[model samples]
Target chain A: MLEIKNLHVKLEDEDKVILRGVNLSIGPGEVHAIMGPNGSGKSTLSYVLAGRDGYAVTEGSATLEGEELLEMEPEARAAAGLFLAFQYPVEIPGVGNMTFLRTAVNAQKKSRGEPELSAAEFLKLVREKAKTLKIDADMLKRPVNVGFSGGEKKRNEILQMAMLEPRMCILDETDSGLDVDAMKLVADGVNALRDAGRSFLVITHYQRLLDHIKPDVVHIMAAGQIIRTGGPELALEVEANGYADILAEVN
Target chain B: MALAKLKDDALAARLAGLPASAASGWLAAAQTEARARLAAMGLPLRRDEYWRYTDPATLNAPEVPSAARFEAGDEAPAFDGIDRLKIVFVDGVFDPAASDDLALAGVEIERLALAGQADIHWAQGTYGVLEARGQTPVARPFAALGSALATEGVLIRVTGQATRPIALNYHHVSDTSDAILHHCVKLEAGANLTLLESGPGAARLTKVLEVDVGEGASFHHIRVQGRDHERRAATHVFAQVQAGARFKSFTLTANGRLTRNEAVIDLVGPNASAHLAGAAVGDGDFHHDDTVFVTHAAPECESRQVFKKVLMNGATGVFQGKILVKPGAQKTDGYQISQSLLLDEDSQFLAKPELEIYADDVKCSHGSTSGAIDETALFYLQSRGVPRAAAQGLLVLAFLAETIQEIADEAIAEDIRSRLEGWLQRHAAKGAT
Candidate 1:
């Protein structure tokens, strides 16, 4: 389970507050949807939770399984079962995706005091995962995100999330650049990895992705705070009427 | 005091009478020039600007006399799997018994001393001079010394229209207790050849190679400097490229106590091209320096120089690269990048990339970066279950893969990579325990 309590964060350089007293909690076997328009601090919440540098946490605490997540390093947080599906994946030249993924997975395992996987075993597992995700094996062999199409990059990210098998994953705009078909495939991949003891926080600008994953709770974020919280029908209301009516009521 | 002075005087006299050679007219002249230069400049002291990073005093000792001949022992060492034409040099002397008469259809491989005077004259006329105008001050001592004592080397002539890649392997093994001066190699026009030079077991060996590529010719030169630990070696390669010719040089300096691989490439003709790439791994108390000088003399020419150095423990590494675009050389594309990674705090690197362009139309840039390994990447790998050493090794390999991947020969590149990985593993194990 992950918990964010009245989190207020600001940029380190300019002291401009981005996330203002936003509170959220998600337990295992639950999916939370945070829908917001541009400049709504949705991505900021993801970065703050993932322990990215340059974000100053002013007066809030983020805990994963009762462990202090905000104080941990980004990679340490990742090893601690926290995953962020980046809105735009980084392009690392001269590093193969398979090599990077293997390193990441093995690093997490080592941190957990687990036995490492051999090259053969890792290859077999990754190839099987690739087939289920509709990802070409050759794409995994190429440099990470280099020369890949936008959709392929997004798919590769999901494939990484699946490979890491984090306990709590924050999907930040995983459905933004994907086409209708790619969106369905990526949603299906995420759903396949879903289980009772795992949770997901799907952040999106559209309600289309939610139609597939079907979140248990829907929250509308405005300016720098979450203004409204409702069940799944809230997504339908926002989709049909838009956030303008909600923004008016919240302001 | 007088008795002690007498002993010192006797030692100096013995050193002076040490049977040094003045053979080969050009070599004699070069030695004379070097002695004069040494008298004026003296042995580069710590105060010299060019030698500031690497002190020559630590390596300087009374010069030993060059050996006259390499004595042949029982059987030569076996190099069974390597298919190239093996040219063996024992104690700095060329061995015909070990060398196959490379009677390829269009290529010519011969000892430089045995080559006809006309051919030697042609080579000297083509590539002998160092184009002294822009030569570095640090090179003065070595150039003078090499020019003075280099008597024999290899001359490889690939005739125009030849296709087979000529492999020239220089195997140096010391038989007697003497220092060796082996100067070898010359490539001719339109001839495409791949030259692999290695110093297997050399003790105090110095080999100088002078290469000349004719118009429209191509040369692939790979130098593997893996001498014995006690050996103090230096290999200098001077290449002169003509119009429409191409020259690519790759150097791997993995093992040596004190090794310096210096290359001077001159783009003499219009539209000529040259690629100089090298990777050096120095651990222990070893010291390695890779210095390159690429000159653009003609218009519309291209030259690229990439050098990578990895050092551990108290080992030291140096990469000094210079790109010079002359006044009339317009539209020249010259790029130089030198990077170094120090694995320990005591390890040191001095990488300086200099660019001097006199032509406004030229695009010349040089960058030098030196840093420790990326800790974030290290932690990233470590958190993924890779042990600390394995993670560091993988990161170092990824860092060096940029340079190694540029090698055109798959086998050679893989060989170099495996050797580097092995070295890293050994160093990591040492650190672990």
Candidate 2:
């Protein structure tokens, strides 16, 4: 469902490269977890696929469902069913969370030549989805991410992913600031959305989150590229003995 | 010396043939007195200290270019369906034929024209009294000019709580009309009133509003400068807040070639409070300025000034606000904030914020900022599938939301908000192309 070959990316404002010659592939219905230490180009790979600016794909090709992802704008990418649950969800002061989600849902639908959900219809759908994630209706009424606790923000991100129902989803460090309870809740939300047609690329620094939402495959990333790829046992190995042995083996 | 010479030259070229006649009585004498002061002080020049940022040439012309009369679309006019006393003015002349009678509960209202040609009345003293009082620290030549030539207005006196708001609705009919309007409001102790003003009065409009708020009185003013894209107007409000009085005013301006709104407020009694706020949206060739001066003369007074402007595509905005606390006015609270959202690289904002304090134990703060939209916020919205221009429009409305909240009346606030939203929607469409 997703493919990247020889992807090399450098900061647009600087010459230093962040992602160099990374190759990855995920099939439909597969949950792939990318475990890496800090600054290991795991998040960079996700950002490059989601079409964020400030990075130049110097040499690489990325496609999703046979459509090139490198040439689309961020919104177009989202409309093309690409979702990125940011590590630090932005706090937009003036826009209410409900308004933001509704606009986003309608926009994606319109881009895909579908009818928009009426206000009443949208409200009902959001309430049902929010109940599962344990998000109070009050959170949706307030401005987007403003004054929300870390757990609430993560839960909100999961709610957005469920509502968008993207074909390919990337969760960038969704477990960084979450407690164990919050992690389990987030994992449950993600597990419920998993299907034969939807795939997820979860990026994390530890295997704590993988316990709840088991991954089909695990990749250990060091420096700028994926150095090793194996079955779910790879995550357990990385968790048991940090990334040192893997780095030595790759070198 | 240079200012004097420049002022003199500007006066000759700008005020050569404007009518300054009034009824033959003390009112006329007051007009003559103000006219004499205007001649001496002259008009402000681009080189003047206060006029440094905004050029006065367009407003100082002998003849103001006529703006195409605005025809409001199917949208219900502002304050529609609200209980109000509608007072109409066409081309700066009172149109009683289309106005409600001056009958209202707890209030006495009279047209300035009724104090006919040969009599001295109560309005004679208040005609230019406050305008002259404000000339002490700053020379507001335009305000003095408004007092000198103004002939079309009303005098309203509130002795108790007014049941309905008074609406001053101006309608423009003449293309080259030059209008000067002066309104005087006196509220007795413990009285309450709300004033609503809207519409494009003329091609070139100058207005002065003087309010005498007695002890424990409450007054509110909300005005929407009409959508005449080529209109040139300068309006001034002079207010005196007595002990424990409350005065709050908010203005929402959508479009105009040039508009200057000046307000001078004096907190004369202990515990008095005053808030002055405005929100303006301007497109290409638009220029809007708000100059406010507030004084704390008695102990424990509080004052706030909040001004926000959104300019796009070569539009310009200017703000010059000052807060002064007198000696022995301890425990005074003064706050001032002026901000501008420049949608593009070419738009501009100029601000001068000042605080002059003589009291040692007072809290005063002021800040000004001019910037483009928050790029991160814009991206966050756009990344959610909202179009780029729509995202920009949302940010602009959010930027102005703070000022809109200053309105004390919820219904009026909602009306102003929708008006701004409508403006943003239309402008966003224009920008998209």
Q: Name the candidate that leads on DockQ.
A: 2
Give residue B338's error in model 1 in angstroms: 1.9
Q: Write the per-residue lDDT of candidate 1 for residues B35-90, one digit (tens) a residue.
A: 45433434444455556666554234454323222232442322223456676666
Instruction: State the lDDT of candidate 2 residue by residue for B1-433, as single tens digits.
Output: 8878888887887777676475566667878888898998998988777788777787777887878888778977888867899999997999999899998899999887665254767666577888899987898988888888778899998999999999999888888888889889999999999999998789888899999999999999999998889888889999999999999999998898889999999999999999999999999989999999999999999999999999988999999999999999999999999999998888999999999999999999999999888877777776667777777777787788788888978888888988888888898888531
Off by over 4 Å in 2: B71-75, B116-120
For model 1, residues A1-251, the per-residue Cα lDDT tens digits are 99989999999998799999998999997999999899999998987887665789989899999998988867778888988887877665567889888888887887788898899989988998889888897899998788988889888888888888999989999998889999998899999988999999999999999988889999999878999999999999999999999999977
Which docking category, incorrect, acceptable, medium or high, applies to candidate 2? medium
Q: Report how far off residue A69 is in candidate 2 (Å).
A: 3.1
Report the lDDT of model 1 for residue A34.
97
Q: Give model 1's TM-score versus the native structure.
A: 0.72
